[model samples]
Target chain A: MLGHLPYALAAWLILWGLYGIVTSRNLIHLVICLAVLQTSTYLILLAIGYKAGAVAPIYADMPAGTVAVDPVVQALMLTDIVVEATVVALLLAIAVQAHERGGSLDPARLCALKG
Target chain B: MLAPWPVALPLVAAAFLAGLGDKLPRRLADAIAIGAAAITALCCALLLAGPPVVYWFGGIQPRSGTAIGIDFAIDANGAGLAVLSSLLILAALFFSLKYFDKPAHMFQVLLLVFLAGLCGFSLTGDLFDLFVFFEVMSAAAFGLCAYKSREVGPLQGAINFAVTNTAGAFITLSGIALLYSRTGALNLSHMHRMIAGHDDSLVLAAAALVCTGFLVKAAIVPFQFWLADAHAAAPTPACIVFSGAMVEAGLYAVARLQGALFGLPQLRTPLLAAGVATCLVGAVMCFAQRHLKRLLAFSTIAHAGVILCGIAVLEPGGLSGAGLYVVGHGLVKAALFLCAGMLLHRLQSIDELALHGRGREVPWVGVLFALGGLLLAGAPPTAMFFGDGAIHHALEAHPIARFAVTVASIATGAAVLRACGRIFLGLGPREPDAPGGGEQDEEPETEAAPIPWSMWVPAAFLLALAIGSAWLPREHAGSAAARMLDAHSWATQVLDRAQPAMPSPPPEEPLAKGLAHAALTVGLAIALALLTLFRKRLPEILRGPVRAVWNPLAGSLRALHTGAVGDQVAWLTLGVAALGASLVFS
Candidate 1:
């Protein structure tokens, strides 16, 4: 079964990240928790495309028909990373403004929209 | 053939507008956004006019049988959605010309990017592209929700929206990774081919994760906590698009993926259950609201649930019914939000209690608001009426579903009607202690002035479409629904370069049944609304009994929607786990 270790690692990261997000008091920490959660996807994508005993996908220096890790998933992972960066940046910016306006970053204290 | 333009055009325009921010005149920026949306809509309409197309980017043909590059597998349904989104964007931009003040071209830029994302999400043949575009839409939406960030309310709303959705997106990406690892395919058609008759745990889990991600976007129950906050705080123009098209995109992706990759009957139960739960829950919470935007937001959730029900039936009649319902419901929801915006602009308040009888000042908006409620209640010959007929015919095999749909429709409609009575007619007793009701002071987006025709005209235009686009005729709707679900033919066309043949649509939904259901819906909506409006006039004995029974149920139902990000995320995770359990075991 292609070594379930990576899957376990990804699952653990996901759980840990969710736990952080659920328990975090501050908005910055929540955003970071979200980033941590996003990191699990990166790991999963890389693990899926990983090829033990295979070379990198840089075919420029490799012999023809050599086994290499999947370039497609790597490409997807790259795009996903870019997207995560944008998301984290945007969330962080909002957190900053929210802190500025409310003088606090604790979501519990940000009681404007809650029940 | 025209697939890419619908997406690419808006993106390029957005980027251009972003670059020219504040340097260009405001009027020019508005023109650019409006022009771009119009052209993109035209392009989508053109795509709809043709046979299904598979336009590969950079001309990377998969003639050798492996999908090497991204492609757009455009069908009538996808093109129809893209056209709808583009048109809504056009309407929003038109309405916003006089709404915002002291803004750079930022709002226009965000809107155009949002349009691009919506188009891309609608037409893309690849799952990864769907995620990318979904992110594009979400990112732009977060920006729009936070554009001014002048108020604490908007900031709180934006933060919750960003975190929860980004989390959902990551889950979806992981799902994509799981599926890709199993099938070695990214293109949906190719994935379908690779997954031939496979219903393994991996597939189930991936399906659960992916659908969970989309349900978040669709703002289904549990994942729906962020929507009311976002919609309530977002600008009126942005709210129109969010409620009208963006949230619905989530449901579309779920259906599209189901048709393409996993059309197993096992998954149907979970989908239907989720749809019904959202429908009932949204209705209950909608009826218990005091904030007009939040009320409309919850109503959006309720109708989205109804649309999901149609898709869950897994038939052409139901699919097409949902399609027409989406057009009818989404447009009416947008019009209603516009009415709310009008109230916000003219009276500078949206609190149900605070704005009591204030709507008389803006009689047109009040009339439009009440009319939107009537359409929502399934007014005869309206688009929703046809949609309801189709759905009822489809769900005829499931009688309990019919009752559920009926109850949900009545509750949501009556909620709107009751609000109309209170805000416009001053008929209801003002109660202030309801949960999350009438909580925020809306910052006026424009100067103190008469409400402009620019705003009301667009709402009226959208309402006209909502009321009458049923003229689209049942046969054509049936055909479009058939094509939308014809996975085999769609795969053959997209991957093998085969000319697609149209399939026959199901028979028309029985009009007699639709009329009966429609009358019941409207009559109950009116009666319930009037009851709530004049409930105090009821004898003390009846009133006491009603409150004793109703207050606790409504309060408990409303309490579950705590509007906290942590609780929402927790519920999302639990929902995903539950969805996976049902898909895996059932």
Candidate 2:
């Protein structure tokens, strides 16, 4: 059970980040919270696929690959990270523009686009 | 030969278009999108004509290996969805030509990418590949959602959509990881074969996780906050794509996964419960909204919930009903969104009051909106009515389930009726002075010339498709349903034997019942139209309190959008945690 500590920690971080996102009023803080939550999900994924004492897929110390973390999860995580980075960047740019146009980053004031 | 190109071409075109989109002429960019879609549609039609062909990437055998390479399986189901998607994208592209002002290239690029994602999602056989396509679709959608970055609503909506959907993608990836660990395969068909014989708790957990991820994408009850904002904030063309095609992809994933992986009886009850809850919540929410686009968004959620009910039955008829509903709703909802866009372009507001009398000005749009509404409400001749009826019949064996479907149908009908009453019927308080020929003449020349055919054509085409697909032969319809039911299941096998004996008209049966239903539906439609004509003098009792209750509910739902970045994150996190826990526990 202790071996799964990292996975548990990741879960905790996700929950913590969610709490921050829900309670925080600041747009930047919300973005940061989302980033944190996303990172925790990645960590949970990586931890789930982890095999104790296994070397990373790239190392010479891997003992001819007797055991290694599932490479599929690694590849998926890598792709996911790239996707996340792009999304965050685009979102921040949008947020910056919204701030400039609306004169405030407060979500309450961004009602110009409401249904 | 043409099978693989439909999915592959759009992907390649998207990359090329995105790179040269800004550098190229607007006409070239638009041509790139429309041309790619036209070719895709042609390819789908060709595939439909041919036998179902399964193209294994790198010649990997299916259901026997680790699914190292991706597979594109072209069944009737895939072909139908592919054709629908292609036509819808083509329509959206046509609309974009007139709707967008500048950055035509960016618009085209995003549109192609979105199409690529949808096509890839529909065709992929590998579960992991589905996740990848979902990500591509979602990321492109986020980009398009915020494409109009100068506006706060678009920005906030995009951010909310990104945060939630990205997390959804991650959870799905995690579910894939768990499934891989348990089954050692990435292919859906392979996994389905393995999972049926195994009862490991981990498989259930993985299914829950994956379904949660999909539910978020599908905008099911609790995870629906981002949809209204994103759909409402997006440009009209993007809105058409978002509502018409994109949401269906999520439901498609759900149906595909349920049929392929968790067809177990134990899973059916919980799924049905979720579907019921989603329908009730979504329908009630739809009734409360005032903003036309937002109302459409909530209505989408309600309809999706109804689709979920069909999915929960896990029968061929139910699956077929769900499939038809997805296609039908895609067309009708897209048309409604585009109509709303047309109204907004001319009237400058989505407020029901603002759009009150303007319906009289744009008779064609008004008629189309009414048609779209009737279709959504499950009136006959339109596809949703058939789909809804099929769902009702499919669930008849399960009383609780039947009751749920009935309530959802009624709610859906009432919501549509209410919206029509408010928008077309003039039951709501009139705008003190509407713009055309009124005190608002001081406003800039808001009434543009009637919308061009490019904008109207796609919407009209979709309407025609919705009506046509509803009239498809029962055998052809039965086959699509059978494919969805996983023919190997005992439930399906029994249902199959009973199907021929059932009342679905023998092959020799004339088109009389269909035509009669159409006539009855049209008569109801005309009566509603007449009501709309005399709505102003109707007693206040019918309209007043109903609007009063609906306004606050809609307002409160909108008010939940505190615009706080944190709140959005919080909801996303909760959603992720719930998904993760479900996956872990199952």
Candidate 3:
């Protein structure tokens, strides 16, 4: 139960980040909040896959062929991290361009694009 | 070996084109895109000829009924989508040859990546892998949306698209994590096998979250505002792909998930309600649009809602209807958008009211646009007629829902007729005296060239396919439906046998129902539209109390959308917390 604390904490961080993203008026802050949310999700995913008393996945002193935490979730988390980074970078670029053109990062002024 | 190439080929082509496409000749880059899509289409055709195959990566295998390796599986549905994607890409590329200016290579590269991501999204067997592909597709779409950075609308549209879509991705990923925690498997089929009868509310919450991501992508109601703006702001060829094929990826995800994960009875009601609301909202929104491209965008959303209704039914016929609608709508919408692009190129504006009576300037384009409009209205000898008819007929088994779908289809048809009337029939502000006066009016200073055959050929081919698919014999249609059903294994087989052994229905059933509905709805719509067309009556109708009631609702909704970043974030955050709470509680 104590070991699962990290997973709960990660989930909480995700919620908090989501709160920040929703309440913040700045585009940069929203992007940052999204990144934080993404990080928290990845952490939660990785934490869920961890097993008690399990050594590092790769270690010389570990029991030979002993079962460890599932590797699938770890791989998924890593891929997700890469995906998140790419998405965040792209979002940041778009936000920067929007700011340059509109002179305001407030989404209220961005209505120039809507139907 | 051929299995993975359908996805990998395009990815490689995308990378190569991005790196060196700009330096290369425009023709060469276009050729590469066409070649890659052609190969992918061929691969899909070959796959369709065989039974479903699962290709495992890294040599991992299922142990104790758990899938430990990544898998890409191809069944009838996937093959059908592959074909649809390839065909749309081919058409977009064909049209882009003359439509675009410089930087042709970058456009082609992004197109290839978009294709690759779509294929990956359709074929991947793991939930997390689906997320990966979803991100790939969304990111590529965002890039394509902003590719025309010289334009302010495209830049702003791309920003809004990125934020909304990114938030959606996060929600989807969170759902995946939760599902993984409950089931301890990533493979979708394995998860299905494991969770089939398990009454875990957590899975339901995850399903809702996962579905929200696709819903946003699909541009269903409440999430549809972004679609019109994005579609209107995108480059013509990009709009073709965006409206034509990209949004379908979202519907595809929802359909696939419903088929695999949420087959339980409890989930069907909410799904159907959402589908119904989307259909109604989309249809109404279509009537409210003034821009040709934006009207098509809303119409596309309406049809997507119809397809969702088909999916909500969860019957074999319903699934087949949805499949048919997806393919049919993709082709017809692409053609419509491509035609709209040509019209816009010639006229430099998208307002139908502004471009009234300009159709005759480009005679062939005018003719094609009219035909495309007919198809959009689901006239006989179009695939949408059969697909939509089947959905309406299937809904007949549920008496209460049938009226709603019938009304929605009628509204959809009427919306198309309204646009067609304005663009093709109404008198314009500046009527050109000559048959070829469009060229003179458009660019009087420069010599006008003939509309390119490259553009006409693809649009004609797609229209032909749409007509031909509709004209296919009922038995052949049944066989195609059978292929979709065959994927469900025993349930499908049992249902097949249990189906009533009455004499086969005539091929004209769908045609008859569609025509009847179209006539009734179009007649009513025209009557109402005619009344509104008289400006004096419009003002009288809008006077005093009527105006008072309408203003506040519009103002409130408009206020809700007041371009405030905080408000958008607040909604996003509220949605996330609501979803997260649902996950935890339900």
Over 4 Å off, model 2: A52-69, A108-115, B48-51, B61-64, B398-447, B487-586
**Local accuracy of candidate 1 as per-residue lDDT tens digits, B334-405:** 899888888888888888878888788888888899999988988776778898888878888877677767
List clashing residue pairs in candidate 1: none
Ranking by TM-score: 1, 3, 2
Candidates 1 and 2 compared: the better one by DockQ is 1
Which lDDT tens digits does candidate 2 get at residues B377-429? Answer: 67767567667767766777777766655555555455555556656656655
Real contacts retained, model 2: 0.75
Query: How high is the lDDT of residue B367 in model 3?
Result: 72
Most DockQ-accurate candidate: 1
**Highest lDDT against the true fold, candidate:** 1
Tens digit of lDDT per residue, candidate 2, span A1-115?
8876886787688677667666665667767766776787678668767887876777665557477767877887887788678767776776778788677666656643331
The window of 10 residues in a row where model 2 chain B has the poorest summed lDDT is B436-445
- Error (Å) of candidate 3 at residue B199 is 2.4
Q: Per-residue lDDT for B185-246 in model 3, tens only?
A: 77776676667777477777778778878878887655655676677777777877777777
Each candidate structure's TM-score, on Cα atoms with residue i matched to residue i, is 0.97, 0.85, 0.87
Candidate 1 chain B weakest ten by summed lDDT: B432-441
lDDT of each: 0.85, 0.69, 0.69
Looking at model 3, residue A22 earns an lDDT score of: 61
